[model samples]
Target: MKFNKKIFNLSAWITLLIAYVLPYQSQSSDGHSTYLGYPLSFLTINNTPIYKTLFMTESIDIFTLTIDILIVYFVMHFANVYLSKVKLNKGMNKTKDFK
Candidate 1:
C-alpha cells in the first residue's frame, strides 16, 4: 500500500469535527460531552488541567476551552498519522510475505 496524503488529511478533518462537535459542559451533571478524544466528565472536572477552574467555578472559560480543543485536535491528528503509517507498513510487509 502506498502512503496517501488524503488519508492523513481526512483523519485530521475528522479529528477537528469531533473536537468541535463535542459539547462543553458547565457542571458535573451537564450530561455526556467530549473534548478532544477523551470523554468529558463533570465529576472529574477537577482532574483536568484546563478544567480545574470548573471545579471551583460554575462558569466555563471560552479561551481555555478553545485552546484545549485545538491542542487535542493536533494530538489526535498526529496520532492518526502515526497509526496510518504503521498500518501501511504492515500492509507492505504482508505483500512481501506473499512473494
Candidate 2:
C-alpha cells in the first residue's frame, strides 16, 4: 500500500484543528485545571470532555477521530471533483468566445 498527499494533508488539517480547537485557556479554569474533571479521551463518544482534562488514552482518541476524519476526506474530495469539472466548463466558454 502507498501513502499519498491526501492522507498527509487531511491528517495535518485535523491535527492542527485539534491543537487549536481545544477550548481556549482563558475559557478554562485558571489555566491550571482542565474544564473536565478527568483527563479527556480524545475519542470521547459523548460530552464527557465538558468535564475533564487529563488527556484521554490515544486508543480512544483514534477511534473517535476516525469517523469525523473520514467525513472530512469525503467532503474535500467532493468539492474538488466538482471544482475541477467546472474549470473545464469555464475553459470551453472562453474558447468559444475566441472562435
CA RMSD, predictions in order? 10.3, 8.2
TM-score of each: 0.43, 0.51
**How much is 41 displaced in model 2, in angstroms?**
9.2
Q: What lDDT does model 2 reach?
A: 0.49
Model 1, residue 38: C-alpha shift (Å): 11
Residue-level lDDT of model 1, residues 23-63, one tens digit each, is 44433345333333223321222334564565453334455
Q: Which candidate is the best by lDDT?
A: 1
2-52 in candidate 2: lDDT tens per residue?
344685487547643764356322233334333211112233222245555
Go through the candidates in order and give each one's C-alpha lDDT. Answer: 0.51, 0.49
Go through the candidates in order and give the clash count of each: 1, 11
lDDT of 1: 0.51
